[model samples]
Target: MIHTLSISELTVSRGERLLFQGLDLRIQAGEAVVLTGANGAGKTSLLRTIAGLLRPDAGEVAFHDGDGNPLDERLARGRETHFLGHQDGLKISRTAREELGFQCDWLGHVQCGMDDAVQAFGLAPLLDLEVRRLSAGQRRRLAMGRLVGSPRALWLLDEPMAPLDARWRAVFADQMRRHLDADGLILAAVHDPLPLPARTLDLGGLT
Candidate 1:
């Protein structure tokens, strides 16, 4: 399997606080890596670093194609890899349908069905409702809908199951399994057990 992401001797610091030091991690295609740690253990920070939202103080994050050669030419890190943070990123005044349309437009081509996503997320009745009026779990479901249209090979999800109910969680687990089976990679920060074949990377142990 080709390594999609590689981190070498990564070190990150916020002010005087050391987030992580001398950390090395490599994630390959078709693999799912679960990031587990207590709150404030730098799990989100690590995800941000990988997503290129924050630069590490030291070390390199390299991307490779299926041939194992470096794919350093790619500029948009979030383009080829979807990063779903804890924040819903929804426009409060916008309706659910509008938000989905905006995300689809940003993603270029739409491979997934918007109606299907709304149905899957149980947002059919809330499609015309403004996001600000939705519950916390409903907002998360809407955010997860963004992934439906993504053509990305890697997914960086922070608390993906946070607002999902039991049924939706099961559906999401199935979706994750299908993603992995299709040679996609996932690195997620999860509090509960993820029902996928995943390798746990404890951020707290990196020090």
Candidate 2:
């Protein structure tokens, strides 16, 4: 029953356009919040702000640890929150196996191994292939696999289901449910219906 994220009077602007104003939201552990909006409604911007990747023009984005106290100032945001952007962050030259190995080492945890992720994402055959050589759907699955392996408490996903097929989508949904059950929170921008229970936040209305 901890509050993972808190946003107050958040005002964000990109160039001359104001995405949203006075946006206040709180995400508690174990909750799934779905972001809904039209193409230009700033759904991705909002997610970025929460993940601490983009500072809001006005207002604050705060994070609290499992004990409900604010995290230390020196703590790295990446340790507690995982941001999965639309464009899968991958090194074109690195093979799928190498990328996962690097991430696992960087995170300093081995809860999920490369073999498990490869099987879960159906990337076994493509393990030796370079990321740039893989199809869009395959790359997305690889990105998702990386995110899932991280030990973050909160996840910010933008269009996570975009490149996934029906089978993979189901697998992702199942993984999401498991994450929620373990007291992790998720905020994803998705156009399609979610398989799990989630509260919808319409970014269009804010614009």
Candidate 3:
């Protein structure tokens, strides 16, 4: 075992359609990997599989601890990883503050405070607003805050920058940069350029 995320010969299909097959990937701490592909190219599906939301048809996905040993599944899913998907993953009735607070608390980092997370996305003003009332981009900013506030080791992000504007995109990039510098790992699916150094894994050819 190694202190890394290793995907070996992964195969995923959708209702009999083979989106991708024989896929292999490896990512380590302090590095970022970006998934690039056209629409319907299985970028989301791959991230979903890595997040444990969807089962892979074949292959193995493993996450090793800092000491390079495989962690138990329960602990791995509980506190070692974070998955931010396409959906807002927020409770509409809850205020931005409450939603983000819950996520940070779930990761056991509530004491870290959400101030930096709020400032990262400029969500300080909208903290008290209900998620339903905020604009789509605003909600996205709040969801992204969970990543910063929680400080999980491995992050699986699907189109993390989708709802952001030009200004926010830069902000998001800086956030990713900081995460990597802190020895965190990132697997992001994106069309726009990532502000930091990222090894690109384009799935366009796999389809």
Candidate 4:
């Protein structure tokens, strides 16, 4: 009856090869879980599957709402969670403010105000600059800020710490910890240790 994200008997295949099979996971509120594996492992594939962007060859993923009832699948798959993939989804032509505002509107993130989002991400100085002019780390920071500004219960992050330097990495890691403290669930794929304590799911032994 508790709020949780459940994956049962998950089986995912990439073309002719089986990436993973008979996998299972359950994520409760406020928990952070990291998925660790090699390049060809099914970490990303599993994230895509859970995001409803990829279909698993078998098994199912579901989210239970606070009321102990399953959330509407349509809403859960599209809006209840934020999935940050390997590629940054940003418009090179748009300024940081413009881009973040557009994303907030697009995602219907009414609870997160524009000013609060900008300030939270320490992005005031970069607001007027076009995304194309921003450096790699700046762009990544903007993306991280955008995530903090947006409201969602679950976050699916793929290699989130890769673009960050030590300081920003710690900053974002702190943000992740804050998110978990707020009872948000996070599932990420990473090669290194997270700044905060986290439970890890290693895919090395899976056949």
lDDT of 4 at 102: 81
Best by lDDT: 3
Give per-residue CA lDDT, model 2, range 1-207, as digits (tens).
235788889999889989999998888889999999888799999998776777799998877877878875235365666788988878999998888777755755556555566777788888899998998889999887766666667788999999889999999999899889999889999999789999998888442
Which residue pairs show collisions in model 4? none
The global C-alpha lDDT for each of the candidates, from Candidate 1 onward, is: 0.81, 0.82, 0.85, 0.84
Q: What lDDT tens digits, residue by residue, belong to model 4 across residues 1-207? A: 225899999999999989989898999889999999988798899999999999999998999977778887668867778888887798999999888888777765667466666776678999999999998888877876657777777889999989878888877888888888888899999999887888999876353
lDDT by residue (1-207, candidate 1, tens digit) is 234888889999777888888888888888999999888888888888888888899988888878888875244374677788989789999998899778766764455567656766677888899999999888888887767655567789999998888988998888788778888889999999799779999887443
* Residue 103 displacement (Å), model 4: 1.0
Candidate 3 residue 165 Cα shift, in angstroms, is 1.3
User: For model 1, what is the error of residue 41's alpha carbon versus the real structure, in angstroms, after optimal superposition?
Assistant: 0.9
TM accuracy, model 2: 0.92
> lDDT ranking from best to worst?
3, 4, 2, 1
For candidate 4, the 10 contiguous residues with the lowest summed lDDT are 107-116
Q: Pairing residues by index, what is the TM-score of model 4?
A: 0.93
Supply the global lDDT for candidate 2: 0.82
